[model samples]
Target: MTSALPDVARHEASDIALALDWVGMRGIAIPLVLGGPEAAPAAATAELAVDLPDPHAKGIHMSRLYRLLGAFAQHGKLSPGSLQRLLREMMESHTDCGSRAARIGLEFHLLQQRPALRTPGLAGWKSYPVSVQAMHRDGITQVELAVRIQYSSTCPCSAALSRQAVRNAFAEHFGDAPGITRGDALDWISGHASLATPHSQRSEAEIRIRLSPAADTLPLLAMIDCAEMALATPVQTAVKRADEQAFAQLNGANLMYVEDAARRLRQALEQHFGACSVAVSHHESLHPHDAVASCATPGWKRMG
Candidate 1:
């Protein structure tokens, strides 16, 4: 005859009598289908945990937590309501350990197809890193969403200095010539030896916001649109000569510093989200280090 399997976690008791702030799992791989305007499948890394208030209890049921997460993969589309429900269920499942709260985090890359700047039918896929975190405690649930965006930054100081250099070159070439025609000026300016281009670098923006408790869905695509529109120089994917020229024109027109980029993003995001924080980094081409700036609305405590 066979006996029942051994149960160590439920039967044993802990020697130590201290509680942990967070306890469970991290980097749990999961397949997720995010529900929004751009609903798509994402391979996500999940972190799940519950409090262990009962010092006497040996340990929490880790398998039960993993199983609960697996259930979500089977029949859930990630959203505020579903996240809240999952956290509540986690707390209920850990009642044996006297748990009062639970938290879940997911990280993934969201893919978007971007059209060429000037080409009508050409497009390519771009990926943005995204994360969503949620917690349930004391009859309240809070959710925070975050996304990372990449753009281009042309230094205003660099542009001004480059323009000065170009003017100096133009003066030397013309040398007070009489009756210089537009064609002659155009020929000189279009040549490679005429103008010095400003320094531009790839930059990144990390935006995190606290979703209103009453929000039903995640407005990720809309938020991304607002930020890209405000900044006006998102990095391109499919590029022909004409599209590249148009992109260069856009960069020349929207020259900005790190501070300018931060302010633009803040003003635009604040119009939509009440509690939002923005951090930007410009990987300077001229310098060894990156330029960075950050800002947040009032009463905005950053979520982990």
Candidate 2:
């Protein structure tokens, strides 16, 4: 009875006789779990495709690819090894149709609980956007991982201008009053320190790195932590009055332009990963446009 079913995909020849680069599914929703101490199931969107190298073939078997993805969703732990295995399986499943290459992409958010800057026992969940890509071509497999980290960037120029304004205010108030005491200065600052305020905006850094073939597990949390530490001004999730004050202090201490941010991230990530690409964007609060900077190590090939 099974043999009576139509197998047109395997039996028929293509009318167009044109080879295609890729043919398969996209926007497939699947459950994925990463390998780590805190790993748990997370929802991910996946794209699975294989190259249609044979111009004479009618079409590749779509059901085989879907079933394999379904099986991975059920029991697979996402890692460089696992993704490579999945891509190999994808290519094998299409050998009858002459597929020579395959690739899989996964996009998801990794949530982490972060503590407040100065508040004890206060924390909140922060979500970071992450993506993983694995490609098998010409008997070689390459895997890449990328993550986006949100931070706060205070404009260095704005900070300097604001400081000058405060200094001018202080001189004006004290130029005529020669007998001013420390208490008087403190009181004046308390009353008018914010006469001019530095402009700060939320910024984001995207780091993409090629995974080493010997890598066994995804390094999502480690990379996130390293990037955040390098930036030194990650946006706070849970903030009390004290935490807000601490955040303000951090912004004032680490005033940076977009170039500064890109350099900081690129230098740190390069040290950690040997080579990496970093792109940073500051959503400008002072203007109608954003300020952006990017840098990559030599010979870095970004995944598409």
Candidate 3:
């Protein structure tokens, strides 16, 4: 025997006349597909949300949203079409509430195999912070991808000071020899390079891209490459003594401040994605707080 229960969501009316902008679940423990159609997808933790524009309805059909998300989770891929379908179903399911839009925020650590700087036989795993956010409204859908990549940031000021100290030391030691031999200079540099090495700290770049709806794939790996390649000193996974030396050399050549790092990432994103925003933070070792900078898709608000 089944007991009769009244469905309040359908039968009851809202006493309060205020309409809400967004009403739905968040941080739901559901898995999502990462990567694209061609690559093997990885699982992700997702937070889902939907908007309600009506003031008369008491609530919405939450289970339908969950079920739609579950169906997408079954696939090993996420594409523009799939995302649009989810958004459409969400609004249709809660048509009584007159829901107009939906949003999905995903957080996950993506893994990539990285080879040692010097050894071909040695390789290890590196994880990067990845997030994808999407919003659908007024027949317009916008998808944004954010990736965090860690690297080494060396101070140019420190490098200049180190060079001056080295020059002073050389003058004090061999000033009388009108000109020092290459061998002597090499000896001094080899011994002193570590003595006054420039300060470098672990840094990360958080990049976000607004994808075109016409785009099919997620382009996760390509987005990663843009940040890593611009920085040129990505944090190593498996490092040998030789690898350490190579990393030191890289830092020496690419010394940058937080602002410089932001500009570099911006240029890289502009060259690749055409329209995007970036907020890069260089966790400053010299200071107590992190150094941050933000860049956006030039004239995004004016654009349709």
Best by TM-score: 2
Displacement of residue 77 (Cα, Å) in model 1 is 0.7
Question: All candidates: CA RMSD in angstroms?
Answer: 1.7, 1.4, 2.4
Q: Each prediction's Cα lDDT score? A: 0.90, 0.90, 0.79
- Each prediction's total of clashing residue pairs, residues at least 3 apart in sequence or on different chains, is 0, 0, 0
Clashing pairs in 3: none
The C-alpha stretches of model 3 lying farther than 4 A from their native spots are 1-3, 35-38, 177-180, 301-304
Which model is ahead, 1 or 3, in terms of lDDT? 1
Candidate 2 local lDDT, 67-122, one digit each (tens): 99999889888889888888989999988888999988999999889999988999
- Would you estimate the TM-scores of all the predictions? 0.95, 0.96, 0.92
- For residue 120, give model 1's deviation from the true position in Å: 1.1
Per-residue alpha-carbon lDDT of candidate 3 for residues 1-304, written as tens digits (9 for 90 to 100):
2247777877888899778878778776656565463255566777777777788888777777888788878863576556767777778888888888887777777888989889779889998888877788898887777888899999899889988888788788787886678998999877875556567789888888788755667888888888888999999988889998898888888999888988898889899988777777778777888888877767754111
Stretch of 10 with least lDDT, candidate 1: 1-10
| lDDT per residue as tens, model 1, 162-205 | 88998899899999999999999888888944368789999999
